[model samples]
Target: MSRLYLGIDGGQSSTKALIAKESGRIIGHGRAGPCNHVRTCQGRAKFFEAVSGSVNAACNQAGIDASTVTFAAVCLGFSGGPEDKEAHSRELIRSTKYKITHDAEIALSGATAGQPGIITIAGTGSMVFGRNAAKKTARAGGWGYVFGDEGGAFDLTRRALRAALQFEEGWGRPTVLRAVLLESTGARDANDLLHRFYTP
Candidate 1:
């Protein structure tokens, strides 16, 4: 019998699964859309669909049956914190013998490869993580866009909207973004602009 190892990196917009042989060689990789925690504004059904799709795609790519996975492990880096993680992990365990943890932990494990170091991740979102020489770990940021995650994509988008509005009210100087936004929205004047904001 053959064994397979699975690694999952769950994100807000997508989930990536890496299937590797017992010898540590990657055999297949698969991806599906958004696997954020179900408890954080989104419900369980959406979360489950995303995860199941990713896992099934991965298994199919590896040409292995879900039941044939002998020594499977999964790492989930989802948006919500411990509570959400526990629930998702439970779901995975009920279905398979995969180990589960935050997606960041898997990234750290890969970056440091079991060593100790600091890692800064800046993608659609941003987060700073550090592991001390003694292996004590800490995270500096990653609060999501609503409360934290300053300079993140959502944060940047919010800032852009604010800037656009400020310029429109003559409270700020005109900028390229303002012109671009007005042109794109086809707003000839403020009266027209009111209707253009957020129609899409």
Candidate 2:
């Protein structure tokens, strides 16, 4: 009998899955919708959908039915912290063993290939992780856009919007962002933009 392993990344933007042999040779790959915990904290249906969808696609890509194959181990890297609650999602797929953790851990391991190195990730979220020569690991940031998310696009956009508003009020430096935002959003003036931002 041959054994297979599954690695999945349920990220903010998309979900990805890869099935491989014990020797690390990949056999199948798949993609699905967003499973970002930060965005779906109110419920877990979307999260489960993302994982199940990707896993099924990956099994199909391997020319097999998901119900017919059992992975030796399944690792799911999710886009949120406190993965303990995800244990309930295990039965959503078939695996002899299953584990779930934050996506950044998977990112670091892939970046270093089991070696010592540091990784800085910035997308819808931001974080920095590092592993030392002695294999000691440490992490910083990743508190979400509302709290820290310094380098994330959301944070950058918020800054730009604030600056644009300030310039309109004649209390900040001039920037072309104000003109561009007006053109893109079809706002009649800076006040219209401000009203839109505050109301919606």
In TM-score terms, which candidate is top? 2
| TM-score for each candidate, following the candidate numbering | 0.81, 0.84
Give the TM-score (vs. native) of candidate 2.
Answer: 0.84
Over the stretch 57-152, how does candidate 2's per-residue lDDT look in tens digits? 988898768877878998888776645535655667678787887778888888888789988888777888888999898988887777787887
Q: What lDDT would each prediction earn against the true structure? A: 0.68, 0.81
Q: Which regions of candidate 1 deviate over 4 angstroms? A: 67-71, 92-99, 182-200
Deviation from native of the Cα of residue 115 in model 1, angstroms: 1.7
Give the per-residue lDDT digits (tens) of candidate 1, residues 103-188: 56667889989788877766556677778778898986777666676766767766776787788888977767667766877888
Q: Model 2: runs farther than 4 Å from truth?
A: 38-42, 182-200
The CA-based lDDT of model 2 is what?
A: 0.81
Question: How big is the RMSD of model 1?
Answer: 3.2
Worst 10 residues of 1 by lDDT: 92-101
The lDDT of model 1 is: 0.68
